[model samples]
Target: MLTSILLRLVGWLGGGVFDTLIGRVADHLRQKASDDLVRFQTGVQADTQIALAQLNAQIEARKLQAQIMEADRGWWVTSFIRPLIVYPCVLHFSAIVLDSTFMFGWGIAKLPPPYDGYEQAIILSFFIARPFEKVARVFAAGRT
Candidate 1:
């Protein structure tokens, strides 16, 4: 009878200990799952914010491109119109002056030919003006 009672008591204590351990394990697992869920939510929020920033950047870039296109159109119109109005008038004026000077004989012949510095000045002016003319040609090409 004594042996039977001792065995029964040992069995009950062992069962209680096992139940307590199982409860602790379940609690630990629940805590870990809660932490994982929080981390996942935080990551999702961060990703959403990043996506929104990227979308905003794309919108701004498109706006800038539209502005640049408008400016380019304005430049194109001015480039064509200015040369159209200015070049022929300037050519006509230069031709008239040359013709009048040649007819009257009161042109470069009236000025004393520089015996010393004139030749150098003419050469230098020609070189400087040539590059300017090439630059003007480049601008004209852009218009067409």
Candidate 2:
């Protein structure tokens, strides 16, 4: 159950940068429409989208902050914990079935296509971001 939750959380959290980008894009388009009003475009549609997204992002971001932090904490903490939980059970069960067979006695099947990169990007992003954030966070935190 925890594994399932972690997998889902990783996928969901990984999409956050896209969410923020979309919110910013909405802001940009709204600005452009207002600036390009020679066509008499009210920019109302874009403005409405931007307004709604700002509110939505703020509320949703606050509600999900904890899961986001946990997901971002560390690569090994989440990534390795998953396989550590899965591999043992998989091996124990497979061992019983494959012990006498000619088939390889201890292996999981290979992932297909995009699913292969799922763990790599989701987990690695935390690792990559952690150090960058530590350095940059000083600016955000302010100093004496």
Candidate 3:
């Protein structure tokens, strides 16, 4: 009878100990998973912030390019160049849009691929990069 009681006591204590060890392992794993999730979220947020900063920098650069052009030039011939190129392109685009929308079938000749590429380069440079040409007098006058 004594042996039987001792065996029962040992089995009970061992079962309790086993249950405690399993619970501790489960808790540790849960905590580690939570920490990993938090780390991943933080990393993603940092990446997003970096991307946004780069985009903002590009926008500011374009704005500065336009501003610089506005400040750097004057006089009729110098000023006339921008509108000279821009107006015709604008009109051409409008005509294309109208023809396509109304199905006018005017068959307005679209700018061929090479010419279109050249046009894009010209427009982008005028609006988004430094002015292509500057007067000799402006440079001689020592003005930036």
Compute each candidate's TM-score over C-alphas: 0.43, 0.26, 0.43
- How does model 1 score by TM-score? 0.43
**RMSD of candidates 1 onward, in order:** 17.1, 30.4, 11.9
| Clash count for each candidate, listed in order shown | 0, 0, 0
Q: In terms of TM-score, how similar is model 3 to the real structure?
A: 0.43
Residue-wise C-alpha lDDT for candidate 3, range 85-125, written one tens digit per residue: 87787677768889999999987777999988877777676
lDDT (10s digit) by residue, model 2, range 65-97: 554556555676676764665555455545645
Name the candidate, 1 or 3, with the larger lDDT value.
3
Worst 10 residues of 2 by lDDT: 135-144
TM-score, cand. 2: 0.26
lDDT of 1: 0.65
In the range 16-98, model 1's lDDT, one tens digit per residue, is 88667768999999999999999999999999999999999788766665664465447776858645644544454455578
Worst ten-residue run, lDDT, model 3? 131-140
- Clashing residue pairs, candidate 2? none
Ordered list by lDDT, greatest first: 3, 1, 2
Q: lDDT of candidate 3 vs native?
A: 0.75
What count of clashes does model 2 give?
Answer: 0
